[model samples]
Target: MTPAGRATGAGRVFPPLPQHPDPQAPFATSWWGNAWIGALEGTSLDAGRLARGRAYAREGHVDTITVAPGRIVAYVHGSRPRPYRAEIRMRTLTPEDWDNFLDAVATEPAHIAALLDKDMPHALVDAAERAGVQLLPGPGDLVPSCTCPDHGRPCKHAAALTYQTARLLDADPFVLLLLRGGDEQALLDELAQRNAHQAAREQSATTPGATGESLPGTLARDALATDYRPPLPAPLPPPAHPGEPPLLPSLPGAPNPTSLEFLATDTANRAHAYLTTGTAPFPTADPWHDAVRLAASHPGLTGRRSFSRQFAELARSVDHTPTDLSRAAAAWRQGGEEGLSVLESPWDPPAGPFDRARGALITADLPRMTIHHNHLTNASGSLQLRYGRDGRWYPYRSEPGRDDWWPEGEADADPVGAVTGMIGS
Candidate 1:
């Protein structure tokens, strides 16, 4: 059949795969991409047509693919002289679904971070599902059609295009999002606006008597003028002796004689090196240690107090409890380097969890799985199967325990089934 030129659509165009001089695998490397191909293969009634489609994909028959909201268009080279035009269409989420999904995304900061990093975290997918949004396509969700003589619902031409599209999805998850009815930039902008609005509301709620209104112009101006500026400093008198060195002030509160002595010795050494070699002192890499050193060398009560308050704020930002910070502080006071070392080391988990998980997998006759820390990782690194406290397996897209695991459907109780479902069979 002779036809016209390339297929055109109102969406982004993905260039055709480069011709492989040698035959290559048609399947996608990413699990999500494989899942898409799986849906296509599983839904087709004829295995022969599916096989032909895979061959066509492997041979690089599909031309540039166009993807838009709810639709995909492509040109596939067939037995005939002219390439056939193929199109695959999926149901786009409704406006209400998008709203619910966006709301769910707004509830978690990690969702935005993951998306920005080009990762689609399973936790975000679970949240969307809970919000009544189906981010991933299920069976029958994709409908394929091609302008070819073959009467098959998705002829080899269309199937080849679908398989190629999966490869595209594997490279860029945003393509999947765009297919679901969201423009990438628009989605990010909306998320940013929502987060900013939420922050403003929270700030207003926390402020006492905040009415969300600006003060009267004249009163606001007068208040700002009175409180915003600091008094100018007076000029200091000349030195009493031009040749004599200046005296330094004594530090207040004494601040542990041992710490002070170390500070004095270290500071003098650094000062001498700087003067002799014209080199600057190296800054401490650890913020906590730097803070302690600064506090130790501080000249007076005010300086020490400022550094102490700053250190406390830093600890709070890292989620350290008051007791934890106090213990670390005490360690610093007793033996500076040794105490910090104790605080910085990560605690080891008991071997019981790993042993139990391994035993379960062994009993299930899946001995190929490699154990890593509290999780089992596959060779591809796409699936992370974690052992939970409830004696069940959890599949995570990221590091286990860093975020919620992906939800298991019918295969929840079966560890092997869960792993297969996550990364595909």
Candidate 2:
């Protein structure tokens, strides 16, 4: 039998769920879908209502579901002839909050890559949370309503609709993004555009003559003539007093003495191999995995702290601040090397006067060419100059607990002059 359609609002129609001879699956296969169900079950006060809702969902009572930013609407078949209308509304993130969330996502390529692969990593969600944008709905966020006479916050009909929606979310994670005020294509396009812009800026920074002025004849010739290969370090001499046995250094009051000795010997052997061969014996392409392997072999270092220390050391080697390393560590812990790479990857500065200024800085023969949001970072990644909305460039330096782009100097309209002055200082 064909179910009747009910007109809810302008051009919005809710069609009843098709009846099947066999009962449908009770829950979604995906973790996200299960998370939705968990959220629903966690909120309901009455166990009977939830049980009935599960039955209603399994029996295919839910109709075609419609989801929009901040709203979900559906119809569920019940004992009554007319279907019950159900709607669930979630408070959407504010424009500023969304901007901040997007900024965080843009900073890391892995976040977008994970979403593109239909996997929403917890790291991305945590980053959004830190940015004051709640991507996932919490207990109080899911506001449910139903036309059914039941006084429960989410009547069985509404619960059934939500359960079905979770199934939809399982199929397409972008539905959550849609609920968060952006369509899939729109978000992808925005990310692509941002990535491309950043790539272009990097290219411009690298290209020798892309800027208006060409390098000086002597300098260009000298640069071309210079040998770029690094000189290999001299091998260490054999340990003094070769006849004496090498002592295993022991930490005072250390536990597991034998294990510590083995670990120390293994570490020294590996270091010697790396020094002699100029390569790792068990080389891994992934630094995170390499660190984990090292930690596994060591007695004291293990778990998140070990991974974090390795990540911090790597970040420091690349001149990134501790704050940046902390974010990277969080991403790595949540999503491994892919997450770490995302955080490490430089994002393009937002389109504005900043891009032109950065281009000008590159033209002026400045080293290091990363443009992040309104800030232009030097090759060292320590010094930064930010372009303010007031049409002035302000200087900044990396400092712990001061992650925000706080300007330290007088603002100047001239980007090139501002950068030059900062560099000179």
Candidate 3:
């Protein structure tokens, strides 16, 4: 009944789950899938985005999704020609948490069957929580990021992808485990070992005066000397597709049944993938990038008027300010991970479009321009052109008495033309 903390699997890319054909049909058919939707909706600060995201999911805007330990990534199309990349990330469980969860499951054989059948009872969940294992996402657990410029904690595109993810969970609960850290086969394998040890201990217990030191066991070296032992079982095959999310029984005082089911569905899918492929997902290489990503996606940092207290304490712990967070957050809103890299890592672009744009700006003869590392600014410092490592131009306008900046213009490929267009606005 406890949410197993340590699910085991590497990352896997999943094809987009089919959009429901009927408009009137519910987005999530199974109880588990509904639970996933509930977590997303309940945590989101912006109702408008949730509504739009639901609409987008129904219309089939989300692209192929990649699920890995602690993260979900996909592309969602909106008003633009290019689909925006969106991702949601959560914290994985610690080793102790996994040990406790697996131990709990082993204590009751039915729990194992319940998971295999894609259902987790509230009793197990309560047991897990009692032991300090959080099986389902609560508010602020979901950290959302997007390449689009919208400043919403989860913009419409991210929301849409999140909505679609619920269906994937409905199809397979193992995906939830994958979200945590372990895959289906790995967990099962561990459970099987526990069962074996338990049986051995029971046999030893029945023996008269059998102490711990008197337990019957053979050394691996001795066993290897003989060849009569049975062969190991064959590797497990992957599920044809991730199965449907398991159901949690409805009961009074039970945790949100839907949310548990949603996680169950997600866990099932991940287990399926791990069974098929032995490969595991790896974490991103850059530590700095990861930190910035957390800051940008913090639920409290969504807007000027809206802030999460949790995010505030987190920022202070890391010695960062809201202004610093906003500056990087805005850059992330524009360019995702790359924008953060560009914001601090100054690099001089080779002479090409940047040079051409400078010439064009000079030709206009509006004001004397000063050039610094990757930046072109007028004498008044009101208008500036900051070039990215990728050769794309990001325009920034200085605010009176404020050091921070926001992107003002569009059409970055043609920096000169873009400067003429939105700088005036």
State residue 424's C-alpha deviation in candidate 2, in Å. Answer: 92
Per-prediction count of colliding residue pairs?
A: 0, 1, 39
Give candidate 3 regions above 4 Å deviation.
Answer: 1-9, 206-425
Candidate closer to the true structure by TM-score (higher is better), 1 or 2: 1
Tell how far residue 324 is off in model 3, in angstroms. Answer: 37
lDDT by residue (tens digit), candidate 3, 86-156: 88888887788888777877777787787888776666667677778887777788888887779797889
lDDT of 1 by residue, 63-182 (tens): 777677778777688776346667888877777777788788976889999889877877988999999988778778889887677989679999989888888887888788877877
Cα lDDT computed for each candidate against the true fold: 0.63, 0.62, 0.69
Give one digit per residue, the lDDT tens place, for model 2 in 1-425.
00001111112223344443345544677777787887788889988888788788878888667676667776577775346657788765566765677677877889989989998888998998898887787776788888667989778988888877886777678777776666666667766777766677788999987864554566667678967868899976744321211222236886543344335645675666665676776565665445434433332222232233433454565565544444443434423443333334444445867668767877888755576665677765566765554456666555534554333334477877766776676
lDDT of 1 at 76: 86
Give the number of the best model, judged by lDDT.
3
lDDT for position 412 in model 1: 40
Please give the range of 10 consecutive residues that has the lowest summed lDDT in model 3: 298-307
Superposition TM-score, candidate 2 onto the true structure = 0.44
Off by over 4 Å in 1: 1-10, 19-26, 209-425
